[model samples]
Structures are given as C-alpha cells and as structure tokens.
Target: MLKYMLMIVFSTFLLCGCSYSEEKISTFEGQIDYVSGKQIKVDCSNTVAANSEESGDQVGVGYICFAAINGQTKLEDNNGNSLSINDFTIEDKIKIFLESPKNIGKSLESRKFTASKVILIKASPAPK
Candidate 1:
C-alpha cells in the first residue's frame, strides 16, 4: 500500500512539473539560425500579441531552441496557405508552436523539441 501511494505521488509531481509558458510559448517568435534535415534552430526574441484577445496562450520559454518538422508538423504562411519544410530559408522570421513543448530546466533556458506548427512571416531586406 505504501509503495502504491508513493508511486501515485511521484507521477503527480512529474505531470505537474511540465507546464507551458503563456508568454514565451504564445509568442514564440524567432529567426532561423540553422537548419539541418528535419530540424531548425531558432534564436528566440521579442514579445508578440501580448495584449491581444487570442486564445491558447502559454507561459514562459527559452532564448534558443530546436524545432523539428515531421509528417504531423503544420507549415503555413500568414495567408493560411500550406507550405513544406523545404520552403523555409535561413534568416527567415517565423513563429513556432508546440502542442506540448518542453523546456530546458526553467524559464528562458533553451528548447530541443518537435514543432506542431510553424508560421512564416517572410524576412525583408535591410533599408539602404
């Protein structure tokens, strides 16, 4: 009986420990730093839609992370058009989303997980 209780307690703790960051995850904006095969490294920066009425906003995030694209990953443009991983280019601005993204230890740490969706917001050239 004691063993069962301990197991239940441990399981609860593990489940509760995994939480998404509303601020960071909701506004997961970054630039493509590197890409290799199915994964892309993003340099996290800035807050987006902080005061909007959008839903599904999670909290906390990292400064850098790796998001992988697979069969289930959704790639799209701002117009809601479909896209493929090949369409992505380095230095492109993007906002990534994860169904259940995991973080490294604590807030603003780092991430290395698969992406659920990726939205492209094409990069523009610098002003002359």
Candidate 2:
C-alpha cells in the first residue's frame, strides 16, 4: 500500500517536471477580431490552408489566437504608455507576448495561451 502510494506520487512529480510547455515567451503580431470582458480573439495569419483547393481561397490558413487577459497582462500602446482593456477594438493591430508550449510534433499557434503583454501597434481608424 505505501509502496504503491509513493510510486504514484513520484510518477506524478516526474510527469509534471517534464511538462509540455516550453517555458518560453513567444510573440505574434495580429489584428484583433473579437473582444469580450477578459478575452480577445486575434487574427494572426493570412495564408491559405494546406489542404485547401488551389482554385481560390476555400479554407483560409489564417490563425486566430484567443488570449486571456489578467492582472499580470500589461496593456500598453506602441510607446509603452499604459492603457486599459477598453482601449482595444476590433481590427486593431497589436503584438501579443505569451508563453507557448513546446512544439511537440504540432503547431503551437493553434492553441490558446495566456497573454503576458499586449502592445497596441496601430488602432483602427475611427468609424464615421
């Protein structure tokens, strides 16, 4: 009984030590597509999907990343001026700094990650 319990605990620790995350901050520049209370959807790509038909743009290979904002996420302008989340709007160009998982035989861009910093590159022009 005790032997089995210790073995399980050790296995759990070992698994956690070899986590899939890369422990590195990765960044990508993109335009904001959707924004909610604490999460934002960013359009980060514009290429065509590999499996899409070559006739036209059947399936877009565009990558949209959903970033979850928190107190730690620093929202700033291009000049490093602090800003509020409300300042963000659709189509705004921004660069997001986030922690990415290790590229384990897959594209990490397809997964959502917590945004560490959001820097507004360019705000969409005011609507008429």
Total clashes for model 2: 0
Candidate 1 accuracy as lDDT: 0.67
| Per-residue lDDT of candidate 1, residues 1-128 (tens digit) | 99999999999999877644453353377788887668988865333233222334342233456787888988899898998877777888998887574443233344666788899988545446
RMSD values for the candidates in order, in angstroms, are: 9.4, 10.7
| Candidate 2 structure quality by residue, lDDT tens digits, 5-123 | 99999999999877644333377677999988698898754421332223345344456767889988999999999999999999999998875532211254554778889999999
Model 2: how far is 89 from its true place, Å? Answer: 0.2
Q: Which stretches of candidate 1 lie over 4 Å from their true place?
A: 1-27, 45-63, 101-110, 124-128
The number of the candidate with the highest lDDT is: 2
